[model samples]
Target: MEYLVLALKGGCMGVADIIPGVSGGTMAFITGIYDQLIDAVRSFDFEFIKKLFKLDLIGAFEGPHLRFLLPLLFGLVLAMVSVANLMHYLLGTHPVEVWALFFGLIAASIIVVGRRIGEASVSNVLIGIAGAVFSYLLVGMIPVTTPDQLWFVFLCATISICAMILPGISGAFILLLLGKYEYITGALRNPADPGNAAILLAFVGGCIVGVSLFSRVLHYFLERHHSATVSLLTGFMAGAMRKVWPWKEVLDTVTIRGKVHVLSEANVLPPAYDSSFMLALALAGAGFSGVIFLEWLSSANRG
Candidate 1:
C-alpha cells in the first residue's frame, strides 16, 4: 500500500514536471516525500560508488534507499513518457484552465509550507521575503538566445535540474530561461539521431553530477535549518504564484521547431466577470481543495 501511494505521488510529480512554471519537487512536498526524496538522492555518494567499484553488489544495493526510490521513479518516468504529450496539448489548447488549477495548487502549497516553520521569527520572515522577491523576478524575466552546443546543454541541465528538486522552482522554465528548452525538446523529438543522442547523453550526465552534489547540500540545510529553509521554500512557492496566474498578456513570442513559445508575458486581470472567469475560479477551487485532501491523506499515511 505504501509503495502504491509512493507511485501515485510520483505520478503527480511527473505531471507537474512537464508544466513550464511547475516543479516536480512541489509535488514531492505536497505528497510528504520531500525529505525522503532528498535522502534517497543523497545515498548515492562516495560510499555507494566505492561498493560498486569493489564489486560488492549487495553492499552497493543496500547503500541506497532503493525500495522507496524505485517505485517512485517508475511512476515519475511513466507519467513523463505517457502523459507528456497530453499535457502539452492541454497547455496549448486549454491554457487558462491548466494555469488556474496550478495557481490554486501553488497557493495552497505556500500555506502548507509556511506552517512548517517552527517559529515566526523576524529573521525567518525577512529571509522568506527575499526568497519571494527573488523568485518573482526570476519567473518574470524574458527568455534569451543561447548556444546549442553539447557543453552548454550539459551546463543548462546541471543548473536546471537543481530547480527540479527545489520546491516551487520550475526546471522546465529554467531551461526556457537558459534558452535551451526548445533545443532539448527538439533533441527529444529526434533522439535516434546521433547528434541528438550525444546531446541527451551529455544532458543526463550533467543531471547525475548535479543531484549527486546538490542533494547533499539540500539535505544538510534541511536538517540543520529546518525552519529557515521551509520559510524560504514557502516564499518561493508564494512568489511563483505570479507565473501561474490564470490570465496573462503575452508581450513577445517566437516560433521554434514549429511551436510558438512565449518570450515574455505580463499578468493581467481577467475581463469583466463572465462565464470564463467563473470557470477558471471553479477549477482553481478544485485544485486548492485537491491539495488539502492530499495533505490530509499524507498525514494519515504517516500516522
Candidate 2:
C-alpha cells in the first residue's frame, strides 16, 4: 500500500515532468515532498562516494540519507518510465483537456508560491517582475541548434538539469529549445540504435554534471533566502501559465516514421452571445477552482 501510494504520486509527477510547461518540482511542492527531495539530493557527499567506490552497498546507501532518497527515487524513476508511454498516448488524443488541467495547476501554483513572499518590497517586486518578463519572453524564443559534440552535450545537461530542478521550468522544454529534445527523446524511445545510444549517453552525462553543480546553488538559496527565491520562482511560474493554456488550433500535422506530429497555434474562443462561451467559461472556472482546492489541501497538510 505504501509503495503503491508512492508510485502513484511519482507517476503523477512524472507526467508533469514530461509535459512542456508543467514542472515536476511544482508537483513535488504541491504534494509536500519538495523539501525532502532537496534534502536527499543534498545528502550526496564524499563519504557516500567513498563507500560507492569501495563497493560497500550498505555503507554507501546509509552514508548518504538514502532512507529518504531511495524510496522517493524509486518512485520517481518508475513514474518517469511509465508515464512516458502514458503521456505519449494522452497528448495524442486529449491534448486540450490535458493542457487545461496543467494550465489551472500552474495558475494556482503562482498564487500559492507568490503568497510565500512576505513583503512587497520595491526590490522584490522589481525582481519578481523581472523574473516574470524574462521567463515569458524566454519561452517564446525559437529553438537553437547546438553542436552534438560531447562537451556541448555536457554543458546542455548542466543547464537543462538546473531548469529541471526549478519549480516553473520544464527540462524537456529546455531541451526542445536547445534542439536536443527530439534527439534525447528519440534516444529514449529507440535505445538499440547506435545514434540514439550516443545521444542518450551524452544527455545522461550532461544531466549528472548539471545536477551536481546546480543542487549546491539551489540548496544555498533555499536555506539562506527562502522567501525571495520562492517569490521569484512563483513569478516565473505565473508567466509560464501563458504556455499551458488549453485552447489551441492545430496548424499542421505531419507523419514521421509512421507517427503523427502536431503543430498548433494558440486560439481564443469567440465570445458568442450564447451557450458555447458559457460552457468554456465554466470549464475554465472549474479548472481554476480545482487548483484552489489542491492549494487548500496543501496548506491544510502544512498546518
Candidate 3:
C-alpha cells in the first residue's frame, strides 16, 4: 500500500515533467518525498558498485533503496509514456486553464517552502532575492540555435538533468533554452531507428552521470544548509511564476521537425473581466487549494 502511494506520487511527477514550465522535482517536493528522493539517489554509492563488481547481484539489489525507488521509477516512466498525448492535446486546446493551474500550484509552493524557513535572517533574505533574480532572468532568456551533434546532445542531457531535479527548474524548459527540446522529442517519436536509438542511449548515459554527481552536491547542501537551501528554492519557484502566467503574447515562432515551436513570447494581462477570466480565476483557486489539501494529507500521514 505504501509503495502504491509512492508510485501515485511518482505518476504526478511524471505528468508535471511533460509540461514545459513544470518541474518533476516540484511534484516530489509537494508530495513530501523530496528528502527521500535525494536519499534514494545517494544510496547508489561505492557499496552498491562493489557488490556489483563482486558479482553479488542480490547484494547489489539490496545495497541501495531499490524497493523505494523502483516503484516511483515505474510510475514515472509509465505516466510519461502514457499521458504525453493527452497532456499535449490539453495544452494545445485549453492553454489558459492549464497554465493558470500550474501558476497557482507554484505560487502555493513558494509559500509552503518559505514557511519551512521559520524566521528569516538578512543574509537568507538576500540569498532568496538573488535566487529569484537569477531564475527570473533565466526563464526569460531566448532560446539559442545549436548543433545536432552527438556530443552536444550528451552535454545537453547532462546539464539539463540537473535542472530537472531542481524544484523550480524545468528540465524540459532547460532543453528548450538549449535548443534541443524539439530535437529530443522528435527522436523519441522514432526511437526504434538506429540514429534515434543512439541518441537516446547517449542521453541516458549522460543522465546517469549527471544525476550521480549532482545528487551528492545537492544532498550535502540540503543536509548542512537546510533553511538557506530551501529559502533559495522557494525564491526560485516565486520567480518562475513569470513563466507560468496564464496569458502570453507570442512574439515569435519557428517550425522544427515540421512542428511549430514558440521561439519568443511575453506574459500579458487578460484583456478584461469576462467569462474566460472567471473560469481561469476559479481554476487557479482550485489549484491553490489542492496544494493545501496535499499538505494536510502529508501532515496526517506523518502524524
Candidate 4:
C-alpha cells in the first residue's frame, strides 16, 4: 500500500516533469517531500564513497539517506517511465480537458506557494514580479536549434537539468528550446535508432553534470535566503500559468524530417453556451480543487 501510494505520487510528479511550465520539484514541495528529496540528493558525496570502500554497505547507504532516496527515486523513475505515455495519450485525445486540469493544478499550486511568504516586503514583492515577468516572457519566445555537437549536448544537459530542479521551468521544455526534445523523446521511444543512443547518452551526461553543479547553488540559496527564494519561485510558477492555459487553437501543423508537429496559438474559450467550454471549466475546477486538497493533506502531514 505504501509503495503503491508512493508510485501514484511519482506518477503525478512524472506527469508534471513532462509538461512545459511545470516542475517536478514543485510537485515534491507540495507533496511534503521536497526537503527529504534534497537531503537524499545531497547525501551522495565524498563521505558516501569512503563508506562504500570500507565495505560498510549499510553505513554507505545510510550516509546517503538511501532509506529516503530509494523509495522516492523508485517512485520518480517509475512515474517518468510510465506517465509520459499516458499524458501524451490524454493530451492528444482530450487536449482541452487535460489542459484544464493542469491549469487548475497550477492555479492552486501558486496559492499554496504564495502562502509560504510570511510578509509582503518590497524586495520580495519586486523579486516575485520580476520572476513572473521573466517567466511569462520566456514561455512566449520562439525555440531555436542548437548544434548537436558533443560539447553543445553537454551544455544543454547542464542547463536543462538545472531548469528541471527549478519550480516553474521544465527540463523537457528546455530541451524543446534547445531543439532536442524530439531528438531525446525519439531516442527514448526507439532506443535502437541510429545515433539516438549517443544523443541520449550525451544528454544524460549533461544532466548529471548540471545537477551536481547547480544543486549546491540551490542549497546555498535555500539555506541563506529561504523565504525570498521560495517567494520568487512561487512568482515564477504563477507567471507560468499563462503557458498552461487549457484552450489553444492549432495555428499550424508542420512536418520536419517526416514527423508531423502541431504548433498552437494560445486562446481562451468564449464565454458562451459551448459544451466543450463547460467541460473545460469543470475539469479546471476539479484540477484546482484537487491541488488544494493535496496542499491541505500535505500540511496536515507536516503538522
Candidate 5:
C-alpha cells in the first residue's frame, strides 16, 4: 500500500513533467516528497559504487534508496506512457485553454514559492530578480534550426533534464527552446520509428548523466543556501510565465520531419469583453484556482 501510494505520487509528477511549463519537481514538492526524492537520487554516489565493486549487488541497489525510487519511477514511466498523446492533442486543439491553465499554474507557483523563501533579503531579492530576468530572456528567444545529429540530441536531453528536476523550470520547455520538444515527444508517442529507438536510448542515457551530476549541485545549494535557492527558483517560475502566456501571434512556421512547428510567436493581448475572450479568462481563473486548491490540500495533509 505504501509503495502504491508512492507510485501514485510518481504518476502525478510524470503528468506535471509532460506539460511544457509545469515541473515534475514542483509536483514532488506539492506532494510532500521533494526532499525524499532528491535524497534518493543523490544517494547514487561513491558509497553505492563501492558496494557495487564489492559485488554486493543488493547492497548497492538498496544503499541508494532504490526501495523508494523503483515504484516512483515506475509510476512516472506509466504516466508518460499513458498521457503523452493526450497532452499533445490538447496542446494542438485547445491551445488557449491549455496555455491559460499553465499561466495560472505558474502564477500560483510564484506566490507559493515566494512564501516558502520566508525572509526577503536585499541580496536574495536581487538574486531572484536576476534569475527571473535570465529565464524570461531565455524563453523569449526564437527557436533556431538545430541539427538532427544524435550528439546534439543527446546534449539537449542533458540540458533539459537538469531543468526538469528543478522546482520551477520545465524540461519540456527547455527542449522547446532547443527545438527538440516535438521530436522527442513524437518519438515517445510513436515508438516504432526506427530512428526513434536510438534517439530515445540516447536521451535516457543523457537523462541519467544529467540527473546524476545536477542533482548533487541542487542538493548542495538546497541544503546550504535554502532561502537563496528558493528565491532563485521562485524567480524562475515568475520568468517562465512568458512561455505559457495564453495569447500569441505566430509570425512564422517551420515544417520539421513533415510536421508544422511554430518557428516564431509574439505575445499578444486578447480582444476586450468578447465571449471567446471571456471563456479564456474563465479558464485561466479555473487554472489559478486549481493551484490554490492543491496548495490547500498540501497544507491540510501536512496538518
Candidate 6:
C-alpha cells in the first residue's frame, strides 16, 4: 500500500513534468516526498558507486534507498512512456485548457509552499521577491539558436535536470527556452528511430550526472535553511504563473529547423466575457480544487 501510494505520487510528478511551466519537484514537494526523493538521489555518491562496481548488490540497494526509489521510478517511467505523446498532442491542440489547469496548480502550490514559512520575515520576503523577479525575467527571454549536436544535448540535459529537481522551476520550460524540449521529447517518444538512440543515451547520462550532483547541493541547503529555501521556491512558482497564464497574445513567430513556433508572446486579459472565457475559468477552478483535494489526502495520510 505504501509503495502504491508512492508510485501514485510519482505519477503526479510525471504529469507535472510533462507540462512546460510545471516542475516534478514541485509536485514531489506538494505530495510530501521532496526530501526523501532528494536524499535518494543524493545517495548515489562515490561510496555507493564503489559498492555497485564491486557487485555488492545488497549494500548498493540498501544504501541508496532503492526500496523507496524503485516504485517511484517505475511510476515515473510508466507515465513518461504512456503519456508523453498525449501531452504533446494536448499542448498542440488544447493548449488553452492545458495551461489553465497548470496555472491553477501552480497558484495553489505557491500558497502551499508559502505557508511552510510559518512566520514570514522581512529578509525572507526580500529573498522571495528576488526569486520571483529573477524567474519572471528568465522565463520571458526569447530562445536563440542552439546546436543540435549530441554534446549540446548532453549539456542541456545536465542543466535541465538540475532545474527539474528544484521546486518551482520547470526543467521542461528550461528545455523549451533552450529549444531542445521538442527535440528530446521527440526522441523519447520514438527511441527506436535510428539516431534517437544516441540522443537518449547522452541525455540520460547527463540526467544521471546532474541529478547526482545537484541533489546533494539541494539537500544540504534544504536541511540547513528550510524556511528561506521554501520561501524562494514559493516565489519562483508564483512568478512562473506568467508563463502558464491561459491567455497570451503572440507577437511574432520564428522558424526553428523548419518548424514555426511562437517567437514572443505577452500575457493578456481574456478578450471577452464570453463562453470560452467562462469555460477556461471553470477549468481553472477545477484545477485549483484538484490541488486542494490532494492536500487533504496528504494531510489525512499523515494523520
Greater-TM-score candidate between 2 and 4: 4
As for model 6, its CA RMSD to the true structure in angstroms is 1.4
lDDT of 3 by residue, 1-303 (tens): 989988998898888877778888888888899989989988899898899999999998886888899999988877776777777788899999999899888888887778887659987898889888888888898887799988988899999888888988888889889988767866765678999989888887888788888999999989899888988887788788888999999999888667787878998889888999999999999988998889889989899
Candidate that beats the other on TM-score, 2 or 3, i.e. the better one:
3
Give the number of the best model, judged by TM-score: 6
Worst 10 residues of 2 by lDDT: 262-271
Better of 2 and 6 by TM-score: 6
Candidates' TM-scores? 0.94, 0.82, 0.94, 0.88, 0.91, 0.96
lDDT of 4 at 207: 76
User: Candidate 5, residues 1-303: lDDT per residue as tens digits?
Assistant: 989989998998888788877888877766678789889889999888798999999888876887799999999988987899999999889888888877877787777778888778998999899989988887777766678778988899999999888877889878887888877887888676788888888888899889989999999999999999989988887888888898889999988778887867889997466887777788888877877887888789789
Clashes of each: 0, 1, 0, 0, 0, 0
lDDT of all predictions, in order shown?
0.87, 0.71, 0.85, 0.76, 0.84, 0.85
Off by over 4 Å in 3: 189-195
Q: Candidate 5: worst 10 consecutive residues by lDDT? A: 139-148
lDDT of 4: 0.76
Cand. 2 Cα-lDDT: 0.71
Q: Of the candidates numbered 2 and 4, which has the greater lDDT value?
A: 4
How would you encode candidate 1's per-residue C-alpha lDDT over 1-303 as one tens digit per residue?
A: 878988988899988877778999999998889999999999898988998999999989898999999999989867866776787679888889999999989988887778789899999999899999988988998888788888899999899889999888999889889998767766765678999889989998898888889999998898999999998998888888889999988989998767677878888999668998899999999999988998988778679
TM-score of candidate 2 to 2 decimals: 0.82
Candidate 4 residue-wise lDDT, 1-303, digit = tens: 765666666666776877766778778777767666666667778777798999988888876666566666678766665666777678789987887888888888888888887778999999999999988877766566568686787788888878777777777777777877766665666556768778778877887677767877888888888889888888788778777877676676667678666554656665466898889889889988988999898778769
Candidate 2 on 262-298: residue-level lDDT in tens? 5444556553535654554566667668767877977
Give a tens-digit lDDT track for model 6, residues 115-176.
88765899889889988998898788887667889999999999999888877789988998
